[model samples]
Target: MPPKGKQATKGQKQIQEENQSTLKFYMYIIFGINAAYLVLQYIFFYDSFTALYIILFLWAVGVNFGSYKFMSSMASKGIDLNMEAGMAEHAKDVILVTCIVQSISLISNYFWLLWLLVPGRAFYLLWVNILAPWIFAEAPEVDEKKQKKMERKMRRH
Candidate 1:
């Protein structure tokens, strides 16, 4: 027979795995939507060849570097590094933020002052480079036991 605590641990592990799978599914869905948007960008803004690639490259670099910094800081703080989650979250944020800033500026429709929009992309890139990793890099870890305990606690409420 398993130890009393061990049984709870096993149960907890199963629940944790289920939760992770569900979360991953959602993350993939979001990623797919973002990817589709990227393709749509090409179709709609066919004239913006250089801008699209530049934006993508900037986003990727921002995410990677941001994640690296986050992981490093976590290590320094004695935190477990969930680099995959960090990267995924950072990628999503960079894309989301970039699109929002770009779209909003465009919708303002001030063609006479088109140059004002040029800095929007640059601003996002700079902001992410400086802040993204620091913002999303070091999240709390969810071990099976902690996850189950949280679930049980949450269900109580």
Candidate 2:
């Protein structure tokens, strides 16, 4: 690493920018492919579940995106949120797998059951995100007397 007084070299900055740009391009491509699959689902099978699948696809993407933003913000604050981030990533994987399985379920039985997990995960993420503020709340400070009284009460118990 460079000394504290020195900024990153121009070459390092350029490399970092190029890497981020490449990563962003790849991410967009993957998302586009998923969207294309949903479009094909609509074209080939125009039914009630078709729209539901589309909505769920968008919802899953939104949840994952929100999780990414949340983790980035937490990291900026010097906090680690690895578990929450992992769940978000796992939820995305589960949804994608469910989509693929549901598509193939047309020929076979039982694959539709996997679709249940998508909404379940969505609800789980919704509940957790809604409660995120309280999850990180700091405890109120107690004056010395109150702290001693609480400690005494704990000992008495």
Highest-scoring model, lDDT: 2
Regions of model 1 farther than 4 Å from truth: 1-11, 56-157
Pairs of colliding residues, candidate 1:
none
Candidate 2 per-residue lDDT over residues 1-157, each given as its tens digit: 6568756444545545544553354356446655665666667656644566666556546654554455344434444322346543453365356546545654443665676776787778777877665788788888999999999999999
Question: How far is each candidate from the true structure, as Cα RMSD in Å?
Answer: 18.2, 9.3
- The superposed Cα distance between candidate 2 and the true structure at residue 115, in angstroms, equals 8.5
Give the TM-scores of the predictions, in the order they appear: 0.32, 0.36
The residue-by-residue lDDT of candidate 1 on 86-113, one tens digit each, is 4445443444454444344333423214
The prediction achieving the highest TM-score against the true structure is: 2
